[model samples]
Target: MNSYIRVSLAVLLVALAPVHSLFHPGVNTITPDAPKLRSLGAQQGILRSVAGSQNLKSQDSLRLKGGVTSILKSLKDALFPVETWEMPKFFSMSAMMFMIIYIYTTVRDTKDTLVVSTCGAESITFLKVYGVLPAATMFMLYYSRISNIFSKKALFYVTALPFMAFYAVFAYFIYPNREILHPPIPQDLDERWKYAVSLLSNWSYSLFYVVSELWGSVGVSVLFWQLANDIIPVWQANRFYPLFGQLANIAPICAGQTVAYFAHLSDKGDDAFGVALQQTTVLILAAGACFMLLYHYICVLGERD
Candidate 1:
């Protein structure tokens, strides 16, 4: 067999392995050891002491004033640092990361909701077999090949521009034609083939799920972290990483609200799925572009140093 064919089969097997494990019940299950309550209590006490120490530090700082002003000052100091060159990079990267996480969450939710609604539960298993697994393997391969050929900065554009174009095309043309692309299933199919045929019939939605899953791996995990580590210095990272992590936690709350608001708008429409897809596609593409631009600026800054 050709090397490509072998790789393709490997990808399929790897995808199917998870589903196989899920079916075999106790084959994978192991009895849990008894909980170590004494050890757990000790760890909880240690955590409480550490948190108490941090709270004391904040209290010390806030005690300078006696009223609400003291509380406000402490909160402000905790969130925002004294301004420095690194501060802008920190804020920009945090904002970009927020957009990336928000868009990924929104798109993934939209795709999964659409798939389950349109094709049902078994379609999810079929999609893993036919869609996500292949896309993930091919993405890794593409990233590997490109990392060897392109500079980190160039690689961002190489990967991102194509995806932006894909989303754009999907939003403007392909998504609108989703119903046409996924035609009604034939009544004559063999019983064995019917389930598979039903899934294949909803190809457009499956493809959406595949692409949305890739955004987390390729767009956020690979591209964003690579750029962050490249720019952020080791010494500063200890202090700044925690702050940015807090910002990351807050991002999901904001993203959830944003998604809910759009979902509300979608509910008002006659074609809710179509409206949601259109809204999410535009948001994903816009976020992707902004992330690329921010990354380009970071690259430029790195070169200047």
Candidate 2:
């Protein structure tokens, strides 16, 4: 009986392999050559970048495009004269690698791990359904009434758009500014008090990262799900949910390919323009999503039987 159960489990695992791979961070389609392009561009003092490369009008210049090789190659060029971009790219890659490994290990250990994954899901749904969304809706509605705010739909777009625009701008600007914020802590702490102070400081930074990640994940997840329910019919939820979720996965796949394609393109002098193009594309997507959601809600309200 135990052997039969093991065989059945093994078959189930095989059946689910493709679905599991879809979400696996390590299973990226982006090639390893992308970093090489960034490094080369760095060596040439050409400001190596997928975005930069994509901007070049010259047909000879490398164009960052969708592929594994293109991404690493682009990064290789981006490294430039002083080899400065390498460290940041390394750190980013390391974090990604660690996340992939950690998630893989956790999934494997789920059989013996006492983690209440379902309980956490329930807690999230409970909070969003009962507490968070309700509070947010009330707050927004109240503010809307007092301010005679434009349609809730307009407010949603207004809130979402500025945040997105800010994020893109911040990524380009404030992201680099982080290096300035991270000063080296004094290691000359011979005293216990100094050590305690250093420990507290480190803890504070760690706490900030944890809070940021948690808030970002929760906010996006809640917004997407709420948007889904608003747009998708209750009867079609099961069918459309899977489809939409798969569509969302397209971002990572596309990012990977873009990273590759842009690597070569950037080498040919197209990075800046490519970056602008991508940013414009994202903005358009956000606008379309917001419009659909608003339209759906309007339809729901108008259909009074």
Candidate 3:
């Protein structure tokens, strides 16, 4: 049926061609509609050209649209690179990881400022062996006991809140009172005993250093990774982890800018370290809180699924 229809249409078009040309006016021949026919052909040509340009324009638009789509898909693959269903958990977990590392960098920097500025650089080596080691051991025992008692979510706060509180007080209170809090050691004391005395003298700074170190070791290495291992499936853990790890570089850039800005603003003053410590402490607390919120959100997402 379709073949017959095509043959009939072809025959009709062929038969009409001569009939249509019979109305044409040649250069020597004159007709009432010669001008009209010439004008009509010209108009037809104009219409044909306009339609062809319009087709080209539409094709160009489609090509541009496809290019934009391809670029967007590439960005999505680079950034998230997770399945559509995985996006919620992936985004939440990755953001939380970024926030954790950001705050940790700020805290570690601040801790160094507190210890080295007050007790000198040599004090750090002594403080870690004498100070951080014992504290880590005690924290390990406490963590074991609490692990049995508190829920995982509650344990996060239990572990983090003290670190956060110490950060607040050390910067605002203890650091300001270092003269009274840290005692003076005699000039002639033995080298080995001198650092021990300094560690004892500047107990607050030592404690700050210890807590900050543990926060890095325990708060992140143990708490966060453990949670991540549980929440993310082993099959997919390979996918989005690296993306967020690189994303963490963003934190250091912002942190470096903040430190430089504070240093610049306070360079002339005797309180240069003081100013940087306070600013970074504020940033650490803020990032820590954001991380807590993000963790809770990710946990909720996990439960929902």
Q: Which candidate has the highest TM-score of all?
A: 3
Which has the better TM-score: candidate 2, or candidate 3? 3
Query: In model 1, what is the error at residue 242, expressed in angstroms?
Result: 2.6
Question: Whole-model lDDT, candidate 3?
Answer: 0.81
Tens digits of per-residue lDDT for model 3, 1-305: 99999999988977876666677535323246778878999999999999999999999999999999999999987766788898888777777777777777777776787678767898888888878899889999999999999998999889888888988998899888878877787788887687788778778877877887898787668767888888888778878667767777887777777777887888887877777788878888888898889888888988997
Top lDDT prediction, candidate number: 3
Return whichever of 1 and 3 wins on TM-score.
Answer: 3
Instruction: Give a tens-digit lDDT track for model 1, residues 120-212.
Output: 877787778878889999999988999899987788889878766766777678878877878899989997776678777877777778888
User: Judged by lDDT against the true structure, how good is candidate 1?
Assistant: 0.77
Q: Give the per-residue Cα lDDT of candidate 1 at 291.
A: 80
Please, what are the lDDT tens digits per residue for candidate 2 over residues 26-69? Answer: 55344467577767868776655655666664434434334547
Whole-model Cα lDDT per candidate? Answer: 0.77, 0.43, 0.81
**Which TM-score value belongs to model 3?**
0.74
**Displacement of the residue 101 alpha carbon in candidate 3, Å:** 2.0
Q: How much is 170 displaced in model 1, in angstroms?
A: 2.0
The residue-level lDDT of candidate 1 at 211 comes to 86
User: Candidate 2: RMSD over Cα atoms?
Assistant: 37.1
